[model samples]
Target: MADNEQDHEHTPLLQDQDNNDNEQHNHHDQTSHRNVVENIRNLIENEIPNGHHLNSSSTPKRVHALLPRLFTLINSLVDCSNVEDEVVTDEVVEYLCSLGQEVVYGLLRCIESMVAEGQRDVGRKRLLDRRAEITQVAAAAVTKAFVDKDRMGTYCHVLSRPYYAVGEERNTAENAIEIAIRVHATDFIADIEVQRCVQALWTGLILQVEEDESRIRFVEYGGLRRSRRGLLDWFDIGRLNVPKYQNNMKIALFIFFLAMYTFVVNNQSPNPNIIEWLMYVFVCGYIFEEFRLIFEGGTAFFLGSIWHWVNIISYSMFMVSFSFRFTASYILTDKSKIVQYNDIAYDLQALLAVFLWVKTLSLLDGNQYFGTMVMVLQKMLKDGIMFFWLLAWVFIGFLQSFFALQKAETKDFNAAFSLLVRGFLQDPDWELAEVLDNKYGFWVFALYLFLTSIILLNLLIALFNSSYTNITDSSEKEYLALFTFKVFSYLKSPDQFPYAAPFNLIEVFFVIPFTPILSKENYKSLNRVVMGILFWIPVLTIAYGEQKRYEELTGTNDDDDIQGGRRRYRHLTLDDISVEDLFMIEDVDENAAAVSGETAIQIANGEEGAVVDASFTGWKSNGPVNETFADFQRRRVKENEARAKAAAAAARAEEASSSSDEDERADAAAAAAAVASSTSAGPAMSEALVQTLLASIARMEERQKEMETLLKQLNVPTAED
Candidate 1:
């Protein structure tokens, strides 16, 4: 009993010793890991961004080694064993963010260096050489990086290529921009250099998308052929695509042009003159562009936002109006019919004009006030959907009762709808009360007014007010998200070389039809020739302005000493922010409302050709997913816990089964021998039985002692209750 007490006392000491060894091992591992992280971080900071290492030359060996290594390090830091062990402390995550930041800085610096050659002469015009010249230098490096890295299609999305898993798949790719976005390196993204590159990159991608989308697959032209690269050379790329002249400037100009065209060529009177004919052709192409979005995004995606519905309704109105105007002038014979069509057409065109101008707000994302408000309004509109739903049900109930209770022989659904709408708009008709002489219909109307105008309307106001407050409180973060979306929107656009609307007319008629018939070289040259011919002046203007702006920003213009762009060495306070908060939209978890970085709560899915997510290797994702980082983490934690429990249970079951089988086999053998000895007969049997009994007894004693020893080893009490 005293020995048992001593053994029990010694057990805790042994456990402490084992635990101490494990702790030491863990400490050693942690120290080693920290050293590795520090070394990688140092290497990234020291080597990747250094001007000497960033070789635009043939032998950029250091860059080649370091860039790949830098990405590898980011991948490791994001997903290594520590992540699974739940030991991914805040420090490590922060350290990981720093490494990602450094990589972004390096890319930005590399671009700045490459483009720096263009601004050497202290002016926009002169550069080291033509290839090394101002506009060309910027285009070549920035464009090539985005264009060549085909897999880097949508870098701004959270669930972009290399799906960020908790333990296994969450790692960055060769695309530097993608890693920067994943790590939420906002300051890095916000930098002038990185912004320019990203802008140009998306521009290049847009150009590619347009080239592909524009192609006609006629069997005559061997069906659905696309050019290799839409913007063939530096000169051919859209001037508006570059920041020099500003794409927004180009978009605003195009809208203004569209508005003017519509007003001037008002075919409401069925007057198809030369200008009207040209306007008709131009609008046809514009309509095509808008309508094609339906096929690409599908019905659910179209219903995702208010803007999408507006696009569908406005364009549909225009098409119908055009159809009526054309039929009235050309197809219809009767004067009365013509007059009726003209009246409807006029009304529709007038409505379309309003929508067209209002849609300019969509492009106003460049300005902080307009852009942020646009986001808020879009959110509120979506929120109001539920309010509108309840209002509809109540209105319908009132309508049925009011119509049923009406003693009048004639009842108009349209009049009923108008009355309800007016009531909601604060112009309720008490005429029903007077006419009905306080009947059931009058009472129903009063109830409708109370429910809809008083109760439902106020509820909606509170909802929008709450939504407005939530959005505006984080206005800065929201704006940043919008800006990221601005960059991302460019990439999402299907048009590879997105010419502003009126200009897209040229591509639709001229470039697309000939693409499949023409050879790759010829097709490319044709696109180049067309873009240059149409936009050389603008392109040249952009180049000059960019170099001029470049000169001004760098202080290269102020003094002979050129104040070239500098590297970001230390992190600014703003740099250290939660990536999830700043960039990623909240997970919507539903397919319809999920898309883009609209906090938007634009958060889903499968594009047919593209098999995206972790398994995909393509540039575009298969489709949008409705998960965010937080959603993924919760799901992954649950899965890991389930798997762990399942594994542990299986192991214990196997261990117990093996132990029970061995014990049962040993006891069966003992029982068989005892039975055989007891059945022995006569003198010989008696002598053998005595011997067998003695042996069996001895064996039983040994077995009992062994069982006690085994129980002690297993921490099972030897004496049981």
Candidate 2:
């Protein structure tokens, strides 16, 4: 009865506990819902001002301010585990999409920053977990904005919004790289609608500008419309003021000329053709463009770029080649002379063509793979210059020696230098000895050959190897520096011409004229007159010419034809063909088995070591057997000791021989002194002194023999013994 009473009391307690837990869970859910709504409301209020649209210039600052709050909310939603949380998150994203380009850009940048930071912080689990969702939502929002606008120009303009444009953080390379990474990670290139959009924006970044005016113009006229900003602005040509854009425009014009040159080369006619007339026009345009670049940038700026020099030399050659070709076809009446002149011109054109193509590599200096190769080659060349100087000094020494010794035969320094070069090439002529009558000539030649061939040449090889290795080691850093320089140049460039020349030239002539007229307050009628006169002719001509050409080339009647066929070519090799024509599996196995059997037989006969097993399944030892560290150390020590003993014995023998030479010289001096002193005494006294000296010399010889015997017993060989 007491146990039953206790059970009834515990059951009531359990029921009360369950009720309290349910109430707390309900309260938490309500609080979360309230927080989500409150945060969303606050974000919208902060980002959008009264009486302004989301795309208004004033909204970018407000949107920037709202980024931190949005990131906080994204973090909170990341750990959310129910359908309600997903619904709230989707609503937040919908609000984000409505706030326009700046907001969407900020949201992407925030996610990128979170991801970049998460890699370094262990406590950023929410960021890591929701990264994919965040990226997907942000990408979808950006895509929607792009579609809604229908203009890649507007989209590209939106992407140029700066995060921090007025502080030390402004123009930061890391910030740009992060933005690029975010754009690349979206895989927007796969989206057919935005492929051109992505490419134009990426090109702007590569040019190191906020936006490329040429690219913007290309997009605008190429058929994209801006909804808020209106379709056309004559004054927008002011963007062409940027130097990088001007440079790019120049490159495009050069490429066009190069294409014309290619067409002329392929024409195959001996006589002048219509293509040659077009080439004259292109050459004139190239000359004008080159001079404009030179005069605009000034002498220092023009000379500073290696590409400029390349351009100058190539154009000069092109001019000469064209002149020669013209003379050969028109003025030169003799057939043989004409052929010779034509050959010369062709050779010059070929050389110029090589240099022109090589200059194009500078355009890809921002690409990692190509840039790395260029940088490595540059470093190798820089270091090789120093090595060249050292080699030159040694070469000069040999050159002068040979020139002086074989002056009669060589006739001049050039002839002697030629001979020295032959020696360097390891083709020294022994027959030159007969021409060099002086005995000293042979010894000098030997010394020159020894120094140049054995020491200097090997040193040059070592220097080259070291330079190549060093360049390879730092290739990554060099590429990064090049990429960063490209970004920084764009960021620091002024808002100016975002297109290259010739193309930019059109804007200069046609567009700049209308800027002043459009800016005036009361010139509506005049503006219309100017627009009709300036714009319609070019626009209509381009449209009609393009349409006519398209119809002619494609043989299609449809005005809105979009389908274009790509030319395809297939390459076939042995591996691409049917296996039956080559070898069957049975035949391959038999050949492999036979080779293995032969190898096994050689190994068994001890003709060769077993480098491979008979089955050809695994490696076998052909090198020396491995030794333990301790055994290796012991062997090394014994070898060192033997070497040291040999060295010591040689040193002692050399010292003993030197001492014997000193003793012999001292004895001869003593005998001469004694004879001089005895000369004054008498003939008999001198004779007695000589006999004593002879006896002493015999005694010294006997002592020398005893010393030799002792040295032999010690196994230390003396000079004579």
Candidate 3:
């Protein structure tokens, strides 16, 4: 019925297209939807070169020029803003899907050959040579197009509501996080080319913005309909914001909370003290947050993670222990009952202590390396679980065999289980010889040892090794992905208004009850006032640090000269050292001058984007002036952002036009919109950068002149003439 109804609904539109084609051409032409998509696919395939055909003339410079056009074509496929869900044409759907597939295929081809096709080292060693430059730049651009939405969350924007204005259409559509998971699931994480691309993307995407101003400044917040700020600007202090990055202050706050939790858990008694009671308040709030997370992330997501499983068991135990402790202290009348409840409570706490502290290691997510290590360990633990399941059945079978070998009353299950375990450990209890003197018992026991000890043990070992290798490469990508998950899942998890734990209890009890009765503005005002009072510490601390960072960033040119251009970069070099008698660091002018001079010559002579590979390790060029690599990467990121801005502008321009020809309209709009977006994206290009662009153009023009002269001298006809 639904299919017939849909066909009836769209029949007129289909008939109109059919009638137009019937009159216009007798057959569809290149201007048709299929042809347009095929053209775009061909262009995408050509950019990848060698994979589609043996074209060797493609260069990084050419890719850079064509990439912007490709993006504009893609963005113009479906007018996301005006396209209604029910009315979306299959032609537009095909175009969108085709673009995504062609882009992915191109990226795979580029990365796989990136290293093999490119190499040419000079006096100074380089990670990637000039030939591989196109591969790196193209791959980076593709990765950015896909993942830029991840950064859009930081803006918490007006333009990106309901869905991002750029790359989204429907509320029911799923975001492509499963791409990462599937890559991980299939053990494709170990592919070196893939990891290299991941590393480059990681180095650019995260290392640049991990300390961006996410939790500073008061601003309007929430959805289009339910948005709020405080009643007055002064009351609009940001106390509920969560940073996308794991900044120093956030790490410090987490450590402080954990420390307090640890102290209370170690020292608290059945009759809780004031401090212990405070900790209980915090625990209650934490469990509340977990429940909220379960609701927001969905039951499947919550249950899928092993950490959540641990959380469920631990929280259950804590609740049970609290019930027992309270019963023993106040409710229980009999002394014997009270003592028994007390013992049970202590035993449960003892077990919970093991769970909580061991889980703490997994929560040490401050460092990227730590996050990656935790991921590896978690994957291996999953592998170990499977082996244990098989081991359990094998052990049970052996125990049953021993039971049948002896008199029913005399069969000691514990003794047999222990003996089997010891034998597996290469120390068979020959003492069990008296119990199992029969040949059948002897042979079955030996067979059990061979199966469990030799075969199963080796299988488990091999599985663990495989799991390790699967996650061996791309640690930085894995780390950033983990943190991004935590941001979307827990820190920025669905809460109409967020309050950190302990303080959250007040919001739950007092604020939530009044929300239905209160007006939106008044509700927000209450939250603002309450948060301004409760979370003064985070607000004040982050506010001061943000202001100080701003001040430092706005330093004079003289400061830049003295510090070797440390603008926007936080890497510490010898110039950062302050001690007068510190001979350990090379802060003196002579060494600094030499390093800077070397880096300058390298940049002037070489033609490559910021490349991160094995050669980047102990890169001597990074030791001094970081202009050679890091600054190049920063410029690349800015360039990407500029493209996004340009696309958005072009989108508005295209919408304003009445032309039905999508491709023609996009080209015209992009030409008009590029000037505005480029100017607004960043500060004016430095004179040196302008000179470099001019020189590059001049060289290209000179080469073109040479080609024309050569062809004319050979009496060849020119296409232009």
Q: List where candidate 2 sits over 4 angstroms from the true fold.
A: 1-305, 326-340, 389-397, 408-414, 422-474, 484-721
Q: Which regions of candidate 1 fall more than 4 Å away from where they truly are?
A: 1-91, 94-246, 249-253, 259-262, 265-270, 291-305, 407-422, 434-439, 494-496, 553-721
**Per-residue C-alpha lDDT of model 1 across residues 1-721, encoded as one tens digit per residue:** 3443333333322233433434456776555433433322322232343111121211123233334433333334334222332333443332222222122333333333434544564553232222222212222233223322321222321122112112322111213443344333343455433453344343332122223424211001000011111222122344354332345545755565576557654643455566656666666666676655555434443454466677778768877987888898899999999989878877887777777777778777678888779878988887788888887788888777666655677656666767778888888888854454345656767787888878888898899999889778867656665565455433334443455566777887878899879998788677767776777776665545534433333333334442365543322443352222112111112122433433222111211111121111112111113333344345445434433443343343334334434455345434443443343122222222223333333344446668878988899875541
Runs of candidate 3 with Cα error greater than 4 angstroms are 1-172, 178-239, 244-270, 425-427, 433-437, 560-721
TM-score of each: 0.51, 0.37, 0.52
Candidate rank order under TM-score: 3, 1, 2
Candidate 1's TM-score = 0.51
Q: Per-residue CA lDDT of candidate 2, range 1-721, in tens?
A: 2443333332312233433434456776545433432322322333343212223342335555656655755565555422232333443544454444454456656666766776787686454636534554554445554444333323333443344422323333233223533333333223322333333333331122223331211221211111112223212232233233434544566677778778777554666677676666566555656676565434543454455677788878878988988999999999999888888877887677788788778777756788877766555555677767877898888677666666564456765666667877899865564355256666766777898788876876776677667656766645554444343334333333332333334444665576676754334344334444544443344335434433343333454444455333222563342222122232234345664576334433331001221110111111122332234345435434433443343343333434557465345535443533334333332333333333334445457779889999999978865
Highest lDDT, which number?
Answer: 2
Looking at candidate 2, what is the lDDT of residue 284?
54
Per-residue CA lDDT of model 3 for 1-721, tens digit only, reads 2443343332222233533443555344423433322322332332342222111222234333433434443333323434333332333232222233233333223333333433333432132232223323333343333223211221111011111112333222222222333222122232233333233222121111111222211121111111112222112243234333223433455566567657766775657677656656766876886787676556766675667788789888888988998899999999899889988887887787777776776567647777778878888999999999999999888888886787667777777778788877888766484466454666777888889889999999999888777666756656655654444343324343567665678988999899899997799789877877876666666445434433343345555545555545543753343222121121233234554575434423432111111100000111112132334345545644654554455455445344434455445444433443354224322211222222332334346668878999999986655
| Whole-model lDDT values for every prediction | 0.46, 0.48, 0.47
Backbone clashes, each candidate: 17, 16, 0
